[model samples]
Target: MEAIVPGPDGEGLVETRLRGWVDPASALAAFRFARHAPSAELAPYLDHHWVVTYADLAEPYEQRIVSHPTVNITITDDFRRVAGVIKGGFSYTMRGSGRVLGTRFRPGGFHAFFRAPVHRLTGRFVEIEEMYGGAGAALVAGVLDEGDMGAAIGVVEAFLLSLEPEPDPLAEETAALVSLAEEDVTVTRVDQLAERAGRSVRSLQRLFRDYVGVGPKWVIRRFRLHEAAERIYQGRDLAGLAAELGYTDQAHLTNDFTAVMGMPPSAYARLGLGN
Candidate 1:
């Protein structure tokens, strides 16, 4: 996929990334997007993301994409595509509010959180919501023209504020773990993580499952793999990448690259150059 970062004079008041559909000629379409959070949350939160959307329709249909952090009072649009069986349309995403850690989706669609520990086990694909919120529409609308994504983000944040304040210690811990995982993908194993967090391995496992939606080991593995992919795309040295990422050997890294990314590291390097 090809991505372009929006310029300073762009529509959305934030840094935006657009991943063009991979199979530009096919009926099915895929798009990945991410928006930088407001300056306040940039340090630890990284950015909000929406990815892996698929759409197909034969008639008029609308779905509500619920909020992940909270759904009781948020107002966002459905992730929508209005096209035919053989006609292709892009499924896009809009994300904002780095302060919020998790959100929900309407049934029949994927639900992803910022938690890396959980992601390592489940992989990237998930089924949580069937539809998306109205905010997604605003994010993608006039995207090429560089419209206002910040306004859409504001809308989603407002909704999160309306929910009840039920404390989720487990969720909080999971979010912390995710933040750590993203910072360093090579740090695997629950016991070590638990030691760092001052918690027992069993407690960490339970908390991760409850809030992160996946196991801790899986999170480390997936994050490492994602880092490897990013390195490959950026033309990093393969040997250095493997060593820096704590791979046992270059062969181990290659096997992981092939198994998870569906191609050797060099293939991604070539593709990264837009060849």
Candidate 2:
């Protein structure tokens, strides 16, 4: 087994709520957030572990979380379940005082545990007990009862250690491919990704459907839009930003952004500026 490592601080792929909300500074002032790296044995199937607490919130804080192409196992005061990939943004309200411990599975990592095509899980969640039986129930209770974050994380780690999922090479490959789409700005199309992966477009699509719970095209477009959102928040020129993000024109980017974000770039920029 390889050594466990700590997750990076303030550099996670998920963007902070401060970018999308107004007067978040006061609400965030009472929040405690941390992400931890998985043990090396679980690294390929797990992205990172996260714990968030807002025990001292004077009022409810609504947090806007950006979407990502990964599944997660989240435990909170209300429920414990495996959540599928969210196609768009979602909000969670933190009230009074509580904490959430989450395990973010890699793009293809959940397949090891699900033993099926991950596409079935998209846009939905499954209760932990449905998959892991009584042990799952005990794990959730133990983690929630533990006051310390380290102890809570340890309970989860021990549960996963018991499962002993076998390594899946395809999951690793799919994760690497998705990482490329996220990191390489030039990878804007399915054909480009197929060429880079040395696979036919159809093969690539199938791979994504089975493991990633989405098509390659969706992944490419999602990452591009993510980049556009950040740039738009930074006050970049829409026309020039569209061209840079591989959009045909500003209108094309606007339509896509409005469809997913429920607002035009200019309106989003206004929100960003107002905050």
Residues 1-275 of candidate 2 have per-residue lDDT tens digits of 01122222334343332233222333345576656778887887898887777666777778766568889999998789988887877767888888889998989998998899999988888899887899999988999899777778889988887887889899999999999999898898999999999999999999999998999998998888887777676667666777777888889999998877777888878765764
- Which 10-residue window in model 1 sums to the lowest lDDT? 64-73
| Candidate 1 structure, TM-score to reference | 0.54
Whole-model lDDT values for every prediction: 0.42, 0.80
How far is each candidate from the true structure, as Cα RMSD in Å? 10.5, 5.0
| lDDT of predicted model 1 | 0.42
Best by TM-score: 2
Candidate with best lDDT? 2
